[model samples]
Target: MLPSGAFVLVVIATVILHCNGAPTNCTITLQQYTTIQIGWTQQQVTQFLGSPGIIVLEVGTAGSPYQMISVQYSALQSSSATASFLFMGGSLYTKSQAGIDAGVYTITSQQYTMIQAGWTRDQVTNLCGSPGSAISESGTGNTASVSVMYTVSGTPYASVSFTFTGGQITSMFEVGLSPPVNDKITLLQYQTVQIGWSQQQVTQFLGGPGIIVLEVGTAGSPYQMISVQYSGQQSSAATASFLFMGGSLYTKSQAGMDTGVYTITSQQYKTIQPGWTRDQVTSLCGSPGSAISESGTGNTASVSVMYTVSGTPYAFASFTFTGGQITSMFEVGLK
Candidate 1:
């Protein structure tokens, strides 16, 4: 009951299929297909794997102009052991093989959009491809963490960092752009005023202090301290204080008062730490309203700077110097 030419056609098809010179028992491994990647052109794929056994084209609708193509090849010398590659707009979109490891899978934009917190590390790797870097840290008693960072192509300032705890993502965030620098004084200029710097060197870096006072201790005693104050920017109600022992830089501090035009925040007040130099404090809170100095016998001296949060007075910061170095400092709020 077979058609007239069907028998002849069967013989011809069998010969064509078996004449490729491949052994019937041959097998292919997943590593052999890893050369394939997304965004490869049709010509590139053809050059890599030779001509495919089947080529299929899906016509586009009136609304969509781009067409899709599928190229299929038989692996392991068996027709059933096949691999399929999908292409869109003449570029490879995806590939899959039967009974062979595909290596690490790749993801599409749609898959990346679906990533969410509470996903396991394995799920993220399978859905978004391998990350560029993975960092792990150990915590106390069964607490350990990992962070995976991914850099997207063509984006210079944007990246993704995913934190994992106990094999599940604990947090995820996108980083874009660097923080802005707010340093009014340049580092090079600041470094010029190192410890033991002479008064002359200090003046060269920052001009003359707004106010200067010298305290003299008892004769034959090494008690001597110099206090200096610098005005801040015209718009800032902050002031800077510098203390010098034996004519060398010792300690410094800054205080800010509330001005009708400028107000100091609680965060700014917390930056004032003991032992900080005058320049370091001023850099944080700007300037102060006034600076004063006092001296006593036996080489004891102190410099105090007043700050106003508003146009009214608010706090006083004082630094005590001994043997030409800062020994103690404190701040007190006004009643």
Candidate 2:
């Protein structure tokens, strides 16, 4: 099939909603933030800081009681100076400096690569070399879910998180780790792929029967979900993150991917904007940006687009959208 005409976009686990023309000198300080009162509307806080804060994390849909959003601002170039604002129901409730302080450096990028979404808590602890700290828990017994965090040391701005239900990871996220120089996908069964291979054929070549992570439509139909993950044997972090839909491979990716994913430009970032439909942005750029990641829950869905420049100064940008319209964005080095 030819590339789709348009796509919805948003950030990953850590949503990056970048604002064009946002004031740069408005980062918050731990001491300065202590003086800011709670119960302030986001706009009031923005006015106090002289800049709008960048939304770094969002959970739940708007107006939902469980909805939560975390925004990060530029700070002093010191590890201890890191800070973020928490808004519950659109009002500032608290502020935090989450990583680094809590031995966030306990997990490394290589360690993170070995863990899978459905892996048990013990499996993760064994691989990561430490029992991850449980930050929150809900439900009970088999229905229980726990959220854990592992901050990577040395790098002041990176951490890994896992949310487990029934003792298996349901979702995971990482921050600040650059995709490896060569994402471990060279030996992926993906290279030997044919467009429409059955699940059995895929399992036969890929060694393991990839699990079915999602399903919809009918039981005995063509839209079944089957996903198989293959990793490199040498520990170069070679991993093939791909999936099969309706008995055919439809999505394929590898770890540490950094190229062939960007499609937006600096000029477009300035022109294309929130509330614009995917069709509108595609029309402006003449191409829909390549999608690097996607995730959704309940009423919210997000996709990522990495736009880059060709020469001297390479850059990357990610914009968020829902209901097929742009809502927010994040960018680095676009010129």
Candidate 3:
């Protein structure tokens, strides 16, 4: 896929007009379309479509969408446009639009891996971490500037696009979408802990043990560090400063550098899923402060935490999560 826009092309299961699953009638499944949205990279698409066959990109195409990126795929032996995915920007488009026939959408005519669709926002976030970035349509019905884009680098991969409207995804297309320039696929998972949540709840969500507390500096200037893992093991350390005298909280992680006084209103701070893109964090937490830390691989990353109240940076406190949900948090500051 190109950097112009990001989209997911998934084949869906819908009633194909009058086809009765007959031998002559080509059977199309919606699986391909849905799978693409869950962050299925171009390599995965290649496994299903086999060599794009035809690749196209229109620079400044009129009438349709600006900075349009698209890819056309053939079913090896078939010479017709079986199916395709379209990406307007970071948000995926749908095939449910007019003129698109569910029966002949070539993208699903062949065989490949399977990924289920109809997942909730949280479910998709949990599975694919967060989109590199996301862009929504303008209120005036015009296209918005491309934010998060997808690339395919140099491989038999397709830039998949997924479109959502009225809360639910409406259509999907494989062609007319940009193939990413870098085909590297990055996976992120969020582990959460909430305030008042017990160790059992933490383990149930994060898979247990890996969670540890470490002390920093001397007894008089001591601080605590919280560490947890996602898919594999996390070798990074997250510091949480409990200022008993000032009644303030401090935390740091591998994502970003953030500092603010928090209140330990509650003794327990739950750890939620982590590894969220800036957009995802903003959508949930607004423009809150950031936490900086290093991953197990020593990779530096930022963690964004938003405060429930707005005022001084350290005047308010909020719970932090890796992805979307709240992880571990504490209340600080004297009433």
Residue 314 error, candidate 3, Å: 75
Number of the top candidate by lDDT? 2
The candidate 1 region of ten consecutive residues with least summed lDDT is 177-186
**Per-residue error (Å), model 1, residue 320:** 83
How much is 73 displaced in model 2, in angstroms?
23
| Candidate 3 TM-score, C-alpha based | 0.19
Model 3 lDDT at residue 253: 35
* Model 1 residue 5 CA deviation in Å: 2.6
Q: Which stretches of candidate 1 lie over 4 Å from their true place?
A: 1-3, 6-29, 56-65, 77-79, 102-335
CA lDDT scores, all candidates in order:
0.52, 0.60, 0.32
Best of the two (2, 3) by TM-score: 2
- Tens digits of lDDT, candidate 2, 46-128: 77776666776899899876678877765544544455777777787665553323433288766775566577898988888
Candidate 1 lDDT tens digits, 135-198: 2232322345556666555555556666666766655555431211221232233424455565
lDDT of 3 by residue, 1-335 (tens): 54433322121122122122221233223444334442234445445543432224544554444444444433323434244544454223422211112232112211101112222334333444444223222221232221221222342354334333333223222322221222111113222332334334444554333212222222222232222222222222222211111111232233211234322222122222344444544454435344333122112222445443444335445444444444455445424
User: Residue 206 error for model 2, in Å?
Assistant: 13
State in Å the error of residue 317, model 3: 70
